[model samples]
Target: MLPDADAVSRAAADLIGSAVRAGATTLGVATGSSPLGTYAELGRRVAAGGLSLAGCDAYLLDEYVGLGADHPQAYRCVIRRELVRRTDLGDGHVHGPHGDADDLDAEARRFEEEVRRARIGVQVLGIGSNGHLGFNEPGSPLDSLTRVVELTERTRADNARFFDRPEDVPRRVLTQGLGTILRAERLVLLALGERKADALAAALTGPVNPDCPASVLQCHPDVHVLADPGAARGLLDSPRRR
Candidate 1:
């Protein structure tokens, strides 16, 4: 486990930098408190001219349904403000499923196609308190594709801090599915705080099942989990690694 979230961020930066230097142009990224530090570090490197995302493309992991692109709490807006604007990627290079689309199913299919064409080289993710990856909450199909999902109360409650009121949080979201996330050549999952301890342990050591969506990562060939001590506390034995 990492000393803290900052260390995790630095480690993630090194990994991402290696990928970028190795000519990986397509990236899949997540938005949330967990990724904020990582994005900040990457942004700093880009600003210092130590790195560049000039022609690289990024796809967001998910977006809350009913929230417009410009909505302050919208995942798209959050990603743009937190990462894309701070890096060299153009407005058009970073894409997200249209949460406000009239035909959400069609939009999901279209987004699935877009990612398939891009062939993501690296995917960064954050697990939910309920062991979810993206918005694929408990009971989500293991082979589900990009699609709409009803947000769990736990998730909505966790995200409520971003809105003025708990009721203001969207009830649904469009997210890349476990199967879709597994398509990436590499995967990095981050978790921090004691709040995530149980979920982190379950995700890494529990059975691979739809009941705990993040557990599906166990099936991936190249999955890296970065966690702080508090988040790794639930593991039976040693969870930390160099």
Candidate 2:
């Protein structure tokens, strides 16, 4: 609940910078307008010679299935344009879940293994309007593994602005499981606007159940959730919604 989105981004960027200063070598990155400001702040710091991501390895939390590597809306390309290309981070140090793989199951296993080996120290995330973490939609199991999932209609429609038409958004994606995300040493979740108010409130104060996947964040020991006034209105207006 900082002043606004810009303030929230500054706080988030400070947290990330602290992690890097503490020798954190692996970073988990997410795609979405919610995190764009934070990435921009980081890039500003790098430009000022106050930070460097050269020593860090970045991991993607999810990727749309069936989108080609060249797709503009692909998580890979989005991250590149928003984060990687803006900072010292290079393509060689970036890793993403292979959503377009021929063997989806095998790809999931490999991605999970790679993430486990890297042992991410800081993970950035953005909450979907429907309480999704990454591409993990409502009803995603708390202990699920890296795997494929169908995009909720609400999520598809929310992302339609990134495509030419509502039908152009990918129907499926490969996302890191709740379990995988919990393994990170730190987690920062960003929520913005009134559109995310209901979901953020449910996730923060409601029961920890699959019906609200992001509710599982309550189980994380080092999770930090940042939301604007509109998004935090529910939490502020009442002690609990459930």
All candidates: CA RMSD (Å) = 2.3, 1.1
Screening candidate 2 with a backbone cut-off below 3 angstroms (N, C-alpha, C), the clashing residue pairs are none
lDDT (CA) for every model shown?
A: 0.90, 0.90
lDDT by residue (20-102, candidate 2, tens digit) is: 99999999999988999999999999999999999999999999999876689988888888888889998788899877899
Model 2 stretches astray by more than 4 angstroms: none
Model 2 error, position 48 (Å): 0.5
lDDT, model 2 = 0.90
The lDDT of model 1 is: 0.90
| TM-score, per-candidate, Cα-based | 0.96, 0.97
For candidate 1, list the clashing residue pairs, or say none: 1-240
Cα lDDT for residue 145, candidate 1: 93
Which prediction has the highest TM-score against the true structure?
2
Query: Residue 159 deviation, candidate 2, in Å?
Result: 0.6
92, model 1: CA deviation in Å? 1.4
